[model samples]
Target: MGGLTTAAILSDLGRKVCVLEQHYTAGGFTHSYERAGYEWDVGVHYIGEVGAATRTRKMFDYLSNGQLEWAPMADEYDRFYVGDKVFNAVAGKDEFRNNLIRQFPNETQAIDLYMRLLDRTGDALSAFGMGRGMSKLQRFAMKPWTAWKLRGAFRRITYDVLSDLTDDQDLIATLCGQWGDMGMPPRRSPFMAHAMIARHYLYGGYYPVGGSWRMAETIIPKIQAAGGEVFTYAKVEKILVENGRVAGVEMKDGHRIRCDCIISSAGVDNTFSHLLPEDVAIKSGYRQRLTSVTPSMAHLGVYIGLKGTAEELGLPKTNFWIYPGNNYDKAVDAFMDNPDAPFPVVYISFPSAKDPDYENRHPGTATIEIVAPAPYERFEKWREETWGKRGDDYEALKEALGSRLMETLYDKLPHLRGKVDYYEVSTPLSTNWFGGYQRGELYGLEHSQQRLKQDWLRPKTTIPGLWLTGQDVLTAGVTGAMMAGLITTMSMVGARKMGPLLRRIYA
Candidate 1:
């Protein structure tokens, strides 16, 4: 999405852009796949803040030329199962607050305080994003003001900040239930990250009208109309650097495309550790800087196909977040320490239920996706093996994990146990095989407090003629990456030009 968004925007600006996607299909994580007459989106589950003509919706409209459409999820978009307790988040801001208040009447004061913090964090987030596109001089000049805006919430840990508001661990867990959206537990994540995600979904969640793949499908025409092309299976072997500047990219097939300027949405780790030359990475200090951040959590994906339609199967549009207990940090730590421990968090999404057009595409079939954190080390030994040909031992391990995830699904929706037609499990290795993350990272870099504090993780890089964007540049999710694209364009083209362009799109 980051790459496509940047290309589409630049294309609109009359700069023809070429998008090289190594995968057989484009859309990065937004891409969808088919198996046994059923389709499932890989990364995109549900997006928020697109129910109306908000900035996010406008950006989508502009990029897709109004071709892209959204289908609003249920008013109760998210359902959290914290152990034996059940909590939910409703659509409107007042409804969400009242729902929380109803759940914990004693925590009204804390809930109100949290809501105020979320409101205040909105401005801080805007400032943080704007600061990413600024030059060193601009950022330096604005440092005091930016720091003041970001001081308390942005600098503090999520758990610490929430704990300050209330001592109720269950309330804290309820507030932090969606921590998996950013791939960090409360203790490790910055409060700003939590607030940004919470505020983003204050309205509700929306699914693409057709499918997630429609995102790239719709945006591709805009790029093509402007004389640009999106090339799939175009694997880039390395980024050609000449005298500390980007020259072009060398394809895996020994073909090279020369361009002075380059914007890498491939991710910070991939750009520095894999694509760039060792000497260049060392010279640029990215080699040492790389140690400051770590890859985000890897995951196991359980894609299930059922015989009946979503309506027939009683699938709800609300996403289910299942937790073993309320101590998110402790649960994560235990699971990380021992693989045998119960999963810290398991996120289940009913794609067929969310997308109103699903039945038209795959008649009488429903798709369910279950995602849970998995350590890369568990599958590291087979990383060198081929994708589908990873030997019986690997297949057995995947089957075991897949069955366990199926039980988790059945535990919630018990009626569907015997109705599954087919299912497959994808390990982190599958992420590397398809998405090209070496460590099979679900999100690019971990959204830790320290990682979020890094000033160098922006669109404009110290390397001349080279820029960075994507989830690593901003936060995570489709919108975050799309916003990174906007920021990257604003950085590439001066504010003088981008200002009018923004007005044309958002106004």
Candidate 2:
């Protein structure tokens, strides 16, 4: 999306542009597919920082030529199901905190602290995102400021945040209603990353109108209007190099497209290790550090084409985050040893939940997805086939897991049992294929304080004229990736001028 969004922006700024995608469609995870009259979003659980005057909202409006509209999640924004206790994650910050406090009246002080953390974290990010992408000297000067703000915020991870926020293990789990956004358990995730999403939902999460696909589609025309092109099935084989700098890109069919520069949202390793020459790789130390870095988390998703809207089935529009009552972190480990292990953590969302008009998009149909942490190794046996193409073992495994997952969903909302009309399962293997992720890795780089704090991963690479973008730089998600586009575009233009452009972006 960073690549596409930036292409749209620059192309609009009058630079010729072309997008190279490995897949047949645009919008990596945001891409959706139609199956038996129902469509499902591969990602996009919920979007934040999209309110009026918000950074994400401004960027989207700018890139989409001002045609995009954001749809707030229906009433009761999000619901957390910790065992049988239900907590409503409302939209406004004070309202949200009050909701949590209402449930756990005794821990009012803890709620107060959590609210402060969310507010403070938002202050830092707003400063960082909209206040000029700091220059080298300014960045150096700002390091202490950044460090001071993040001292406790990013150091301990979200797990520690939840743990500190509430001693009630169940509520601790409940507060982490959307950990799936970052694949890793909160224990390893940077608190800033967690807080951003916490802040997004606190405004109450919203979705894009006309499907999440509209994000790319909206910007696409602007790229053309800027005299550029976005085409499906156009695959980039290698980033063309000239004098140790990016010259253009060579397609799989051996066609060369020339450009003055190359910006890649393909990811860190793929851009550096696969596209650009390794010998001239920028920041060898940074590359070495990433080699030792851990991936955030991958997901095993089940897509169901339900027979009716969630409302008709008596389901809540708000998502249901279900997790095992205890021994939470072990669930990820259990998957590596056993693919068939009972998934302790799962999330279910009916895209049609937010809009009744969805039925107009696919009459009498709704799409719901169930997701859980998945180890890449679990699908190693089926890795041989092309991505997105599943074989026998793949189908069998999917069917089995899909059924078991259905049972789990039924346990929470029994009305869903006979509600599904069509179903399919997607594993890490599918993501590896369609998403171009290595080892079916989800969420660009893992969300760790160590990874998030490292300065090397920022856009500029050692290779001249080559740049990295997407979730690798920013934490993965709609708003973060969109910010990645803003930051990467600034780098391509030169980091020194990043400030003025950001001021304009926010202005």
Candidate 3:
């Protein structure tokens, strides 16, 4: 998403851009795959603010040339299952607040306060992005103003801030039910990160019509229209540096693509540890800075194919986020310490139910995706093995994990227990094999308070002609990565050069 969005925007600005994906297909996480006559999306489950003419929606329209379309999820877009209790997030600001109040009637004041904080966070995030795009001198001049604007919840940990607002632990847990979206529990995540996610889906949720890959399919034409191309199987083996600056990238096929500017959306760890020369990274202080942030938790995904229409199979347009109990942080801790413990969170999405165009593409089939955090250490033994040829032991482990996750699904929707025709399990190693993330980090770098506070996690790099874009540059999620691409372009082209493009997109 970051690479394609950047390519599309820069191409529109009349700059020839080339996006290279190591995988056989484009669209990093947005890419969908076919297996056993069923299609499933890898990452994108649902996005928000695309149902209307919001900035996110406008950017989608501009990038896809208005070819890409969206289908809104049910008004109760997200359903939270905390133990045996049920709660949901409804569409519209008033509806959302009222629904929460309906659930926890006595905590109306806290929910109202939470809504106000979300509003403030919108302004603070804009400032944060602006700060990242600004020059060093520009930032230095606005330090005091920036600090003031970002005060309060933006700087605090999510749990600390929420606890202060209310003593209801269940309310805190319910509010932080979507913590998996950011790959962190409330105790560990920053309030700003939480607010960005909460505000993003405040209005509603939307899915790309057809499939998530349509995003890349539609946007790639814009890049090609401006004399740029997106190439698959074009893996960058190393980033070439000369005299303390980037010159180009060396491909795995021993070919080199020389360019004055190179934007790496592969990730920070990949750029510094694997791509750049060790000496260059050490001298530039990047290697040292990398030590401060840790990789996000890897995850396991179960893709199931059923031989019936979504309605026939009783699939819900509402996403189900199942938790072991209300104490999410403790649940995470227990699972981290003991792998056999209950999963901290299990997120299930019914793609066919949410996408109106699914049945047109696949006449008599429906797909369900289940995602939950998995420690990469469990799969590290098979890291060096081939993708499909991993070994019987590895396959056995996947099967065991898949069966356990399937039980979660059966427990919730028991009617479809025997209806599933096919199912496959993907471990953290699958992420590394497909996405080129060495550690299988789901969200690039973790979104902890320390991680969010790092100034180096921006588009501009100390090395000239080199830039960063992706979830690492901003936060996580499709919109977050897309915004990172926009900010990176703004930093690369300068505000003056971006003025017309900004007007055109927002117009």
Candidate 4:
């Protein structure tokens, strides 16, 4: 998404950009796969702030040339089931607040205060993005103002900040129900990360009109219109450097694409640990700086196909987040320690129900996706094995995990117990095999307080002519990567040129 966004925007600005995707298909996590007449999106489940004419929506419009459209989900977009209790988040801001107040009338004060904090955190995020686009001298000059702007929730831990507002652990869990969105529990995540995700979905959730692949399908034309090309299965072996600058990239087949300016949306870990030369990484201090951050939790995926349509099978557009208990951090620790323990979090998304044009695409078919945290260590032994030809033991382990996830689904909707036609399970190794993450890290780097404080993870790196842009540069989610692409463009072009470009896009 980050690579596509950057290429699309630069192409719009009359600069041709070529995007090389390692995978057979483009769009990274936004891409979809089909099996047994059923298709499912890997990463994109739902998006927020696109139902209206907001900045997010405007950017999508400009990139897709108004070909992309959105279909709103149910008013109660997120339904949380924490240990037997049921809670949900509604569409409008007031409706969400009132629904929370109705459930826990005594915590009205805390709920209102939390809402105000979200508003403040939104402002802090703007300042944070502005700082990323600034040059070293500009950032140094505005350090005092930027520090002051982010002193509140941006610098604090999520659990610590929420603990100050309320003593009800259940309320905290309910507020942090969507923690899986950022792939972190409340205790370890930064409050800014929590607030940004919470505020983003406050408006509601929406899905692409046809499918998630429509995102890349619509934007690819913009890049091609400017005489650029997007090539898939073009795996890059190493980044070439000459005289302390980027020369080009060497492909796995021993071919080289010699371009002076190289923008890598791969990732920080891959760039520093594997792609760049050891000498260059050490001299640039990225090797030492990499130790300060860790990869986010890996996951297991269960994709199910049903014989009937979504409406015929009675699937809701709302997403379901199931938890064993309210203490999310403690639950995660217990599950990580013992695989037999209850799942820390189980998120089920109804993709067929969310997309209005699903019937047109797949006719009489429905698809469901279930995601849960899975430690990469459990699958590390299979690192040397092939993707589909791993072993019998690997297949058995995946079958066991898939069965467990299916039972959880049946527990909620018992009527569909025997309705599933085909299903498959994917482990962390699958992520590494396809997405190229060494540890199968879901959201790139963890969204911890310390990781968020790192100022060096910006567009412009110490290596001249080499740039960075992705979820690692900013936050996770498709919108986050898109915004990071926008900031990278601003940093590449001066503010004078970007001023007119921004007005032209957002106007």
What TM-score, computed on C-alpha atoms, does each candidate reach?
Answer: 0.99, 0.93, 0.99, 0.99
lDDT of 2 by residue, 230-303 (tens): 87787777887777678988887998888768888888777766666555554345446667556656778888
Residue lDDT tens for model 1, 294-347 = 999999999999999999999999999999989999999999999879999999
Instruction: List candidate 4 segments past 4 Å from native.
Output: none
Tens digits of per-residue lDDT for model 4, 354-387: 9999999999999999999999999999999988
Ten contiguous residues minimizing lDDT sum, candidate 3: 126-135
Q: What is the TM-score of candidate 3?
A: 0.99
Candidate that beats the other on TM-score, 2 or 4, i.e. the better one:
4
C-alpha displacement of 451 in model 2, angstroms? 0.8
Question: Model 3: per-residue lDDT, tens digit, 18-90?
Answer: 8999999999999999989999999999999898899999999998999999999999999999999998899
| Distance from true location, Cα of 214 in model 3, Å | 0.5
Ranked by lDDT, the better of candidates 1 and 2 is 1
lDDT of each: 0.93, 0.74, 0.92, 0.93
Flag regions of model 2 displaced more than 4 Å.
Answer: 126-135, 161-165, 282-287, 387-390, 494-507
